[model samples]
Target: MSNISKKNKGYFSEEIVKNYYINNGFKFIEQNFTVKGGELDLIFSKVGSLKFIEVKNIDGINDLFDYITKKKLNFLIKTINIYLYKFDITNIDYSLDVVFVKKNEIYEIYDNIGI
Candidate 1:
């Protein structure tokens, strides 16, 4: 796929995940949140806890954990730190989450492998 097509697919997938979260009672904070060296696909909150979510759209991929690299995990951590620092948020509970999308099916893995 071309770069543009890939981007469009990613955007659509993110939107799908975002809507799913919203429907499930998570309030959306941001989408495509970017910092200096990394980007977070979605940020949401439920109750008083914050969630930094990374979304992946795949076709026929069985191993979802394979998509998250160490480098990507580090980048996400740094990005979340920056977001908290920039917003001066402290003492708030937070966790990293992953959302996997395959066609109309959506699955969420919460605080599983990476933090």
Candidate 2:
């Protein structure tokens, strides 16, 4: 696929994930949050807990677990730390979550693959 097509697919997947979270009662804080180190796909809050979510849209080529590499997780952690420090957020519960999108199916794994 071309770069444009890949970008569009990413945006579409993000939109779907955003809507799914909203429908499930999570309040949206930001999307496509970028820092100097890395980018976070979505940020949301629910019941006083903040969630830094990474949305992965799988095209059946690789397993979901394969996407959460050590380097990627480290980058994500750094990004989240930057976000928190930038916003002066302290003492609030937070977690890093991964949302896997497979067509119409969605699954979320929270605070497991990422710290």
Candidate 3:
């Protein structure tokens, strides 16, 4: 991972997160969904609840939460709204989450992390 490119490191990190969620019974929905102003790293659905995940490859970061800045959360909110409108998702449970990965390990997960 140390030698891998930044882009590949992100993809690798997402795969780890994806498998973890799938193993936990969440169906994989989408990844790297991008719009003009934002991007969603991963999406999942479980029992009518839509889960939006923001993944950060914190290879050398000290604090996991620091990666999720206010600006980033705003972008995520805007992107999720667009996603719901685009897919016509209504009357469903949804939440935002963040997953931090470091050295091929899942460091921490923050759920319902809305501002």
Candidate 4:
């Protein structure tokens, strides 16, 4: 596939994951949140917990560790902190999550990621 096509596919995959989260009872708070060199794909709330989500269209999430390097993690952490500080949100527990979209299946990993 061409680069443009792949980019489009990735965007569609993220949209699908966003809808899935919404359908599954997560309140959509934000998307494609960026500050400086960092980007968090989605921010949401579920069961009273704040979620900082990263959406990926890859086949496996185990490889995510390789892709989201330390520098990127630092950036994302800084961004999330800035967001919380800017919004004065200190009551909710927050976690980093990953939504993986495959061909016909979606997988979610939560709370353990440092990103």
TM-score for every candidate vs. truth?
0.89, 0.87, 0.94, 0.79
All candidates: CA RMSD in angstroms? 2.2, 2.3, 1.4, 2.6
Summarize candidate 3's per-residue lDDT along 1-115 as a digit string, tens digits.
Answer: 2678999999999999999999999999999999999999999999989999998888587767678888989999999999999999999999998998888999889988983
Give the alpha carbon lDDT tens digit for every residue of 12-45 in model 4. Answer: 8778877887998999999888777778788889
lDDT tens digits, residues 1-115, model 2? 5455767777888898889889989999999989787999999999988988898877684566788888999999999999999999998888888888766467544453557
In angstroms, how far off is 91's CA in candidate 1?
0.2
Clashing pairs in 4: none
List the pairs of residues colliding in candidate 1: none
- Please report the candidate that would top lDDT against the real structure: 3
Runs of candidate 1 exceeding 4 Å displacement: 1-4, 107-113
Which is the better candidate, 1 or 4, if ranked by TM-score? 1
Rank by lDDT, highest first.
3, 1, 2, 4
Kindly list the per-residue Cα lDDT of model 1 for residues 19-103, writing each as its tens digit.
9889989999998889789999999999898999898887777677779888889999999999999999999989998888877
**Ten residues in sequence with the least summed lDDT for candidate 1:** 104-113
What lDDT does the true structure give each of the candidates? 0.85, 0.83, 0.92, 0.77
Please report how far candidate 3 places residue 100 from its true position, in Å. Answer: 0.4
> What is the Å distance of residue 34 in model 1 from its true position?
0.6
